[model samples]
Target: MMSISSRFAVGIHILSLIEFNKDGISSSEYLAESVNTNPALIRKIIGMLKKAGLVEVHPGIAGTKLARQLSDITLLDVYKAVNVVQKHELFSVHENSNIKCVVGRNIQDTIIPILSTAQSALEKVLENVTIEDIVKDITEKENLDKRHS
Candidate 1:
């Protein structure tokens, strides 16, 4: 089964960290450390987020922050920002299907609609969830864990 790209998760993680530290600057190096990845990767994702109007970068300080309120940004927004895969095309159909075979010839046409429908369903769920929602959940869970400990 095809899984959502890691860029989607990374974008969300970057945004979450920015939201959590709105008062402070979030440099690519800082974000990279938090994500345990290369700073270049964080910068690339930041560029995408900036293009999508989800984030703004400060060149002088080499840092970034959300362009809008956390409540206004959805997972779908982040998903689109850094995702290299074609939009709404989560499933890739085999291109080498033989035209002579009945199933092979019709496979692309037959499966595309189903995959499109599934992608749409997933997008709808993502649209309902905002960055604020994620941050709130994370904060609650951390607090609960602390209380237990």
Candidate 2:
């Protein structure tokens, strides 16, 4: 099965980290450490987020920060910012199926609507979830872990 690009998740991680560590500088190196990936990769994704107006990258060690409030930015924003999937391409139908076979000839047509609906459903869910929600969940989990520890 084809998987969505990891860039989407990484983009979310970058934003969450920024908010999670708002007091500290969220330089590419810092984000890279939290993400356990190369700083270059983090910077690249940050660039995408910046382009989408989701983040602002500063010069020198000032690092990066969210361009908008957490409540105003939804998961859908991140999803779109990262360009996780091409426009209207969440689902792909195989092309050039045998036109002679009834199933093959009708397969793409039959699945297009279903696929479109599925994609819309997914986007709807993402749209409803904001970065604040994600950060709150993370903070709650951290508190819970600390209590247990």
On TM-score, the leading prediction is: 2
- The local lDDT score (0 to 100) that residue 25 gets in candidate 1 is 74
Question: 30-137, model 2: which lDDT tens digit per residue?
Answer: 999988999999988998999999998865756899999999999999999998887667987889999999999999998999898889899999999999999999
- RMSD to the true structure for each prediction, in A, is 2.1, 1.8
Local distance difference test, candidate 2: 0.91
Candidate 1 ranges with C-alpha deviation above 4 Å: 96-105
In terms of lDDT, the poorest run of 10 residues in model 2 is: 56-65
How many clashes in each structure? Answer: 0, 0
lDDT of each: 0.89, 0.91
| Candidate 1 lDDT | 0.89
- Candidate 2 has a TM-score of 0.89
